[model samples]
Target: MQEYAVIVAGGSGSRMKSDIPKQFHTVNGLPVIMHTIRAFRNYSADLHIILVLPEIQFLFWENLCDTYQFKERYQLVSGGSTRFHSVKNGLSSIDAVEGYVAVHDGVRPVISKEVIAASFFTAAEFGSAVASVPLKESIRSIDPNLGNRALDRTHFRLVQTPQTFRLPWMLDAFSVDYQEHFTDCASVLEEKGYPIQLIDGAYENIKITTPEDLKWAETYLAL
Candidate 1:
């Protein structure tokens, strides 16, 4: 089936304390967002790529693309105030209602092509497939009244991106008014009564929100 990837990159790098957004930061002499786009492009050369970024950052991103001699094709969309709206904008770029769409984090460049393929294949079969990994460390349930108690970590999974879904279903899911609880496409689809399918994702698939994450990605890519 035809596929598309909507890569959202709205980070301002506050946690990384960088002047530029974390997605624009360089890893292994290449921008993080570029690596992310490459992941999808490498997965399927024919897949349509939609990049969502703040309007103000478009020129800068384009200049970076030129500087790196990055020639992979993608349609750029202006980002929204929040991730929900940003993804909505990206989804709107795809004219076709048939096929599958994978919403990914642009800062997460360390994802494997295997996971990318699984996401599309599973989403094609199940309507939606959200990439995730089990929490390795201990977990806890916190409440102001009840204080903190150890909770079963096995029951919880750290949600990652490449949240692939059927194109028509994803478009319909984003048509509703934005909700605060819509943290990911999976959550938004779940609100629309779509069952969320969790797929195995590598632990290396970490979002580059901080300097340490960038370092980790660089190290991972080098190995």
Candidate 2:
């Protein structure tokens, strides 16, 4: 079966305090989104990449591609008002009946090729898979009436992306009415009664949202 990656990069740099979008920020010499795109490309040379970006940022991305001489091929889709809609738009570019699709955050530039392969292959066999890591910190639940209460962290795993699924499964799941709790593709699938398979993800597969995350990406790339 064929493979595809839909990279969602609709951020506006509010958290990073930059004039430019965070995904367009440089991690080393390359733009952060470039690194992310390369990760999927390196995993499978034939993988079709669909980059979902806010409509306003299309010109900036085009200029960056030219400046860096980015030669990898990809289809660009206009982002929507919400992440859910953005992903739905990207899925429109894919063949729903014949492939596997992985939904990824564009700021997560450090996802290893091995993890990428595992996600796609696992989804091919089991229908769906989501990358996740064990939680290392304590967990707590806060409510105004109940105050704060510590919960067992062992029961939780921090979810990451490249959430892979059979193309038809994901395409159908996205057809439902948008819910506020659909934070990730897995959440959308789970709501539709699809079982999710969680696989080990690299700890370094961090999403760069704030200045501190950019610092970490810089240091990691430098090393």
Candidate 3:
């Protein structure tokens, strides 16, 4: 069986307050998305990588690759309007009929090799695996009518990506119509009655969405 990592990057950088997309921003002198790609490349030299980006960003990416002299090999696919649609587009380009596919956030450049390896091996055994972390903050459920209500924070976990799944299972799940509620691959798999296996994720594996997140990523790089 083969392994593939589908990295979805479609940010407009509005939150990061940059003219460039957040994924293209430099962190520790390298593009954030390049760090993400290197993580997967280091994890499995044989693993096929697919980068999903908006069609308009292809030329920009190409220019950057040349400027940086980035010679890593990977396939590029055009993203769709939504994350769900973008992932579906990435999945469609996969040729492996039987294997594992990890749907990861392209901006999450700090993913550890341990988490990536664990998720892949665990998914091989369980058919589905999602990287997650325990919540550190107090929790509450808020309702427009009822205001707010306390809940057991211990029972909840902050879900992250590199949501690994058996290729066939994920391919079938993506075949369904897109739903606004499908925030991640785990949600899509859950909707199809698949049991989600939760694996511990790295705290540093934060999605780069804001300027603060970029700062944090820079801090992590220094550490």
lDDT of candidate 1 at residue 51, scale 0 to 100 = 95
User: Candidate 3 lDDT, tens digit per residue, 1-223?
Assistant: 9999999999988988779999999999999999999989999889999999999999999999999999888999999999999999999998768999999999999988999999999999999889999999999999999999999989999999989999999998999999889999999989998899999998999999998999999998767
For model 2, state the Cα shift of residue 94 in Å: 1.3
**Local error of candidate 2 at 26, Å?**
1.0
* Candidate 2 colliding pairs: none
Tell me how far the alpha carbon of residue 36 in candidate 2 is from the true structure, in angstroms, after superposition.
Answer: 0.5
Q: What is the lDDT for 90 in model 2?
A: 97
lDDT (0 to 1) per candidate: 0.91, 0.92, 0.94
Worst 10 residues of 3 by lDDT: 11-20
Q: Write model 1 residue lDDT over 61-161, tens digit each, in one string.
A: 88998899999999999999999999999988888869899999998999899999999989988999999999999988899998999988989999999
Error of 2 at 215 (Å): 1.3
lDDT of 3 at 198: 97
TM-score of 2: 0.97
Error of 2 at 187 (Å): 0.8
